[model samples]
Target: MTETITRPLSTEEVSEATGIPAGTLRYMRHCGTGPRSYRLGRSVRYDTSDVAAWLAAQKAATARGGDAA
Candidate 1:
């Protein structure tokens, strides 16, 4: 059996997909509030599926009237 590998997305790509600025993404990294990230040395990368899951979770929270506070 063979496992398929998916390329990890750069911050710029994620920014384009999520409309989140790179700086804010960096802040989220620092605060651990955003999607899960993989730190490969100095490079930060995200899995698209993880980002999608996080976005779905955020939407569900909003639908439940949960605040970031």
Candidate 2:
């Protein structure tokens, strides 16, 4: 049997994927208004699934013509 492994994304990768600046991501994280994240030792990571869900919510909000928050 074979299994697939998914790894968490780094901040830079997330920024590239979302078109959001890394600094903004850091600021959002500080303000508690960013995608869900996990901390391991001195590094921060984000699950691709969580980021996808967050993006979906943003699209839904945009379609509804309201703040994504």
Candidate 3:
């Protein structure tokens, strides 16, 4: 038997990897509310690094009481 290795993720895959539900992911896409994503033809993808950066920004904002701003 052979095993296959997968690449990091596309946007939908990233949402699943982060346990963020699809509907919310779609809303985020619509609102531009989440991590930066790239479009490939008709598909959108997110870099793992971008997701991490987004999370770090969110945490820093919360820690600095800048979340609501």
Candidate 4:
């Protein structure tokens, strides 16, 4: 059996993908209002799937007349 490994994304990379600033990502993390993240050593990282899931959840919430982000 073989296993595939994926490197976690940093704040800057996630910001580039989502158009949210790095600082805002950090703030959202602090407020517990954003996508899930894990502490890798002293750096924070986000899983790509988690980011996608969070975006989908936000979109669904907005469609239901709720605020996203």
Better of 1 and 4 by lDDT: 4
Task: List the candidates' TM-scores in order.
Answer: 0.81, 0.80, 0.67, 0.83
Q: What does the lDDT read for residue 67 in candidate 1?
A: 60
Instruction: For candidate 1, write residues 1-69 as lDDT tens digits.
Output: 997778989888999999999999989989999999998788899998899999999988778555689
Candidate 3 residue pairs that clash: none
Model 3 lDDT tens row, 1-69: 896644546766877788888778777978998888777677777767788898889877777544465
User: Which segments of candidate 4 are over 4 A away from where they belong?
Assistant: 1-3, 64-69
Q: Per-residue CA lDDT of candidate 4, range 1-69, in tens?
A: 996768899989999999999999999999999999999999999999899999999987777655569
Give per-model CA RMSD: 5.3, 5.1, 7.5, 5.1
- Give me the candidate number with maximum lDDT: 4
| TM-score of candidate 3 versus the correct structure, residues matched by position | 0.67
Q: What is the lDDT of residue 24 in candidate 2?
A: 93
Residue-pair clashes, model 3: 0
User: Global lDDT of each model?
Assistant: 0.90, 0.89, 0.76, 0.92
Candidate 2 per-residue lDDT, tens place, 30-59, comes to 998888888978899999998899889887
In TM-score terms, which candidate is top?
A: 4
